[model samples]
Target: MLTYQSSQDISITPTKGQDKPWLLLLLCCFWLIPGLVGHDPWKPDENVSMAIISYFMRHSDWTVASIAGVPQFSQAPLYFWVATLFVNALSWFGVAAHDAARLSTGFWMAVGLWGVGLAGRELFGRRNGRLSVVILLGCLGLPLWGHHISPAVVLLAGFAWYVYALALALKQPLRAGVLLACVFIVLLTGASWADALFAVLFAIFLFVFPQWRKFSYLITLITAILIAIPIAALWGYSLKANSSELFQTWWRYYAWGPFGGARSFAVGTSVGFLPTLLIWFAWPALPLAAWSVYLFRKELWQPHWQLLISALFFKSLFIMLATQQSEALVLPLLVPLVLLASGGVDELRRGAAAALNWFSLVTLGLAALVIWLIWIGLVTGMPLTLVDYFARFSPADVHWKGWGFVFALLVTLVWGRVLFRKQPLGRRALTNWTSGLTLVIGLLVGLFQTWIDVGKSYRPVAESLSAFMDGKHAQCIDVSTIAKDPTAALVYFTDLALDARPDNECLFVIRQTASKESATPEVLWSGHRLGDQKEIFSLYRR
Candidate 1:
């Protein structure tokens, strides 16, 4: 049941608290763009996403995502579509296509910050909105996901927008247009219909509670449904017309697919990994969110409380039921958790606030120190033990960039100011903590951009294997039983389509083996091993 308060209700009225928009903008700019601009696509999700976008850009299809001409129906088309636009846009400025695609992810992070701030301001005070942005940026997993081009990034933005719209709708039922638009955006941006449908159902459910069932509320809800149908239908109609196979496949995979297995939901529903993982994964927000809920335990029916609880419950349930419990599945919880946590910022005890600040300073300080140590080790080859340890990993193509160091130094100064400045134990403490966190992250990323890129990138692997190609085209080689990462690496690096064959009418066949002895194949082709002993990729040529 929903408890609806009139627009005149003082309990729900927002207070005008101190909000430093410039400070928020600076933090977001730093947090959002670090590890974004110049990194190569990494393994698993990033490379796969990049591959799909590459395909669409080359083929000019906005309605579907494909990899090496094969439709990857597991994901929706929105992310790739948006990234393609960025790819084209950045090309004018001479940025690499894949790198440009990552810029869009940074943009999404900025949008998410705005959405969080807007939502918080509507439901709580301006101070809460500002705190929410910092809390979200401080999320442990955000730095990893926020800088990459993934469906999860779009979903993050869409979730924030949806929540902001929900807050607006609660205050003025006529403002449901914004909520409806947000729902459509979520669906359009690759979220499953379950989420969009949930938004509509939740809106209607809002009206069912209390005296909120006014004509305006009903009209808003109905209008939302009306708007959603045609938009979805239009996309479906275009999709069906463009590629009937894709249209059917999208529904089959998303709508009719089986829910998550026991293994997928085991940690989520079980007590072992999730609790420990969430401690750090959700970070400061998780603690504050719990405290906020405890504070409002008796007021769960109010719009602010009800919206978060309902959304989190359904999303968590979905995750529990999902056939694969993915990190992406947990992304929806980020904003709701932040919203809930925002409610408790003012209520946090002074001692607790001080502890949080100290915790952030120590944690980020140690992390930054470690990054600096590694950079020094890479540059000077100091400490024989450190050099030996690094020797195990591939040597990153390191070069000294003066500007990078200067920027890091500047950020370090800012972090110092935030830590030493005399600020009160309310939002400023939280802001300084998160600001320091973002600064540290930005400094590390700025200084180690190339090192990070080279360490994780597949470009080196592709370059290494190119020698064995003997000046032959990528199509000249056929791949058999190669893992997904290396396979995608070859395709992206070589800019060639791979042939999946046991024996092919090609110059060479690439095979992955466990050890040197097992590397030899029974086939009649001459085998030459290419990759390191860790990941053996043998090239068999006729």
Candidate 2:
């Protein structure tokens, strides 16, 4: 029912207002698919974050550990405060803290999805908006990250939406300055200091852009910085107390294993490094994207160029500077990519739609093949080499059985209908089939592999500690070895106070490597004894 002008006249135009509701509904469904799979309680980060929440709920103190009845600062307490509210609210209604944390994560993540939809609608027309929402929700990264209640993901999503809204306001002068100020504040609150430099850069970009008609650029810049003052003060205070140790730990993380020297330059190490390069050339949509940018060169030179360039630069720079890297961080930059890609798709004239259709088919086919191979590995009981490699260092077990079948079946059903049916499907049908299938696959893969099965490695250790503390409700004293993961997991699962001193009474130790002689503590539980290393849960009671 929709129509457009000739390819030469094609632009990234907005859709009719009448189409807004339908697009919104599709976007909502895109978010719902991932939400329905339920949250997994097994991720170490999730476990620790939830544990911290539970501690705040049960105790009056907000410390990560209590020493001699004195509270000591640990990580930033903002995330804990948010999690605590959810836990307490859920407990009042009779839900467990863990479930509360899970539900809260889903709720915030859905809010984040709404933010993404709003960003899409503002940057592109309703049709491109629908595509942006679909791509974001369907992407493997978003759904996986959504389930973990880390502030990093929440900040990423929120800051991205704020940036999008700020860009939109930049195009209109009357309210642009105020909106820009407010958005800058929100970005600071959402991401803490992590987003500070990026936010400042964006604010500068907005004020200096030629589109602003009234307010002086200098005045706008001063107002933006003024708005961010409270956030900066709070960040400084948090740093003075809790940030020093975290930076040291982070530095160690960067210097060591996963983030270490040579491996840091590997294919997936930087956020957009690989994907951008790959998509620019090899992706079917590449030509369309190139043509779109080419056609819109004049528009690109205008005020909007600031947004596009700032987003691309900041996203790349931040990821490269990070001690940790993952593809999910690139989600913020997808808006620009979608705009460029859509513009490119628009330039193909009469053959544009046909070309897109073919590209879509090929992409779907490759995705299906990848899914099939994964399923085969799962169902056949063959070791997934990548998973095995991870399991070697962490306390996780990989199961490939049901996951493969589920993915394969889902892919088959959706593609089967799309390929075989001659009748045109409605928007709901397309959104549901494509986005829904993708969501299912993402959740299953994330929950089963990343959280559940991988959690198996830590389960015995966590459970052993749990069992040892059963009914006694004893406060934990000290735990030996701080490898970020095992120590973090112990604190999370057991909600126990940790001590670094070996001389402390009532010590609990998780020895990663075996020793020739046993210590004073009785070994409470042991797991799958391998050669030099076996995860042992021991308790030294005074």
Candidate that scores best on TM-score: 1
lDDT of each: 0.69, 0.50
Q: Please give, for residues 166-268, the per-residue lDDT of candidate 2 as tens digits.
A: 5555444334455556555544544434455566666665555566433554565566667666753564355436657543443333222223333332223
State the lDDT at 257 in candidate 1. Answer: 23
lDDT of 1: 0.69
Task: Give one clash count per candidate, in the order shown.
Answer: 4, 6
Error of 1 at 193 (Å): 2.4
Name the TM-score of candidate 1.
0.87
Model 1, position 60: C-alpha lDDT score: 55
Query: Which parts of model 2 have CA positions greater than 4 angstroms off?
Result: 1-40, 59-79, 92-96, 171-182, 206-209, 212-224, 231-291, 322-331, 348-460, 469-477, 495-497, 500-506, 514-524, 528-542
Task: Assess candidate 2 and give its lDDT.
Answer: 0.50
Candidate 2 residue pairs in clash (backbone atoms < 3 Å)? 288-344, 375-404, 378-400, 395-457, 396-457, 478-499
